[model samples]
Target: MLKEILVHCGHSFCKQCIQKALGAQQQSKTPYSCPMCKLQLGPILELQKNFQLCSIVEAFLASTSKGQQQPGRLSRGRRAEKGVWG
Candidate 1:
C-alpha cells in the first residue's frame, strides 16, 4: 500500500482497500470492521487524511527496490493492494 490510511485501531490500510470495503456496504454510514482484528471502524468518510506515511514509502521505494514484493525486480503484473506494502 503506497497511499496508506491509518485507522482508529492504529492499523494502517491502503486507501483503495478501505474504499472497496466501504463500496461493498449497503449504506454510507455502515461501519467497516478491521480485516485483521475485526474491530468496528467508523464511517470511512470521517477518516482523517494528511498522514505522512506516503512520503516515507515514496522515499523508500525510490531509494531501493525493497518496497516491491519481488526481491531485486518489479512485479510482473499489478498485484492486489492489501493493508501492507507488497
Candidate 2:
C-alpha cells in the first residue's frame, strides 16, 4: 500500500521514500530539501497525510486490479500528474 504523505514543497510522496531520503541525508550540514522541487527546508520536515490522494490512488489501483474503469475524477488527476494543474 502506498502511504502518501505531503511534504513542505506541496508534493506528495510515499512515507517510506521520504524516510529513506531523510535517512540518506542524515549527518549533513546543509538544510533538507524536497526531492521533487529541491526546495531547501528545515532540518525537521513536517509530514502531512494526504488522505484524499491516498483514496484516489487506492481507488485507481483497485479499479485497475479488477479490470474496471477508473473513476471520473481520476482523469483530471492524471492531467495534474502530467503538469496540467487545474
Candidate 3:
C-alpha cells in the first residue's frame, strides 16, 4: 500500500520508493529530495511517517476488500499487474 512518508517539501511518496531513493542517496553521498518536485528534503532520517495518509490507505483497503473472502487481504501475484498497493 501507499505507506506514507512526509517529505519536507510537503510531498508524499510510497515508503518503499522513498526508502529505495534514500538508500541510493546514501550510497552516492547525496541529499534526499522529493521525487515529485525535486525539492531538497534533507536527511531521510528526519522524515516522519504520515499517519493520516496511512490511515486513509488502510480505510480504503478495508472498504475495498470487504466483499472478498478474506477482507483486507490482497491476492498475491495479482497486485503487480494492477499496480495496487497491498
Error of 1 at 52 (Å): 3.8
How are the candidates ranked when ordered by TM-score, highest leading?
2, 3, 1
Q: Which stretches of candidate 3 lie over 4 Å from their true place?
A: 68-86
User: What total of clashing residue pairs does each candidate reach?
Assistant: 0, 0, 1
What TM-score does prediction 3 earn? 0.67
- Model 1 vs. true fold: TM: 0.55
Model 3 lDDT per residue over 1-86, tens place: 56788888788878888889888988998887777888887664676799888999898788658854465556665677678875
Query: 20-72, model 1: which lDDT tens digit per residue?
Result: 77677636655677666778876544555537877787777876575545465
Which tens-of-lDDT digit does each residue in 1-86 have in candidate 2?
A: 87999887788889999878877777575678888888976877778899999999998898878867645545556788877665
- Alpha carbon deviation, residue 5, candidate 3 (Å): 1.0
Note the Cα lDDT for every prediction shown.
Answer: 0.64, 0.81, 0.78
Q: Give the TM-scores of the predictions, in the order they appear.
A: 0.55, 0.69, 0.67
Top lDDT prediction, candidate number: 2
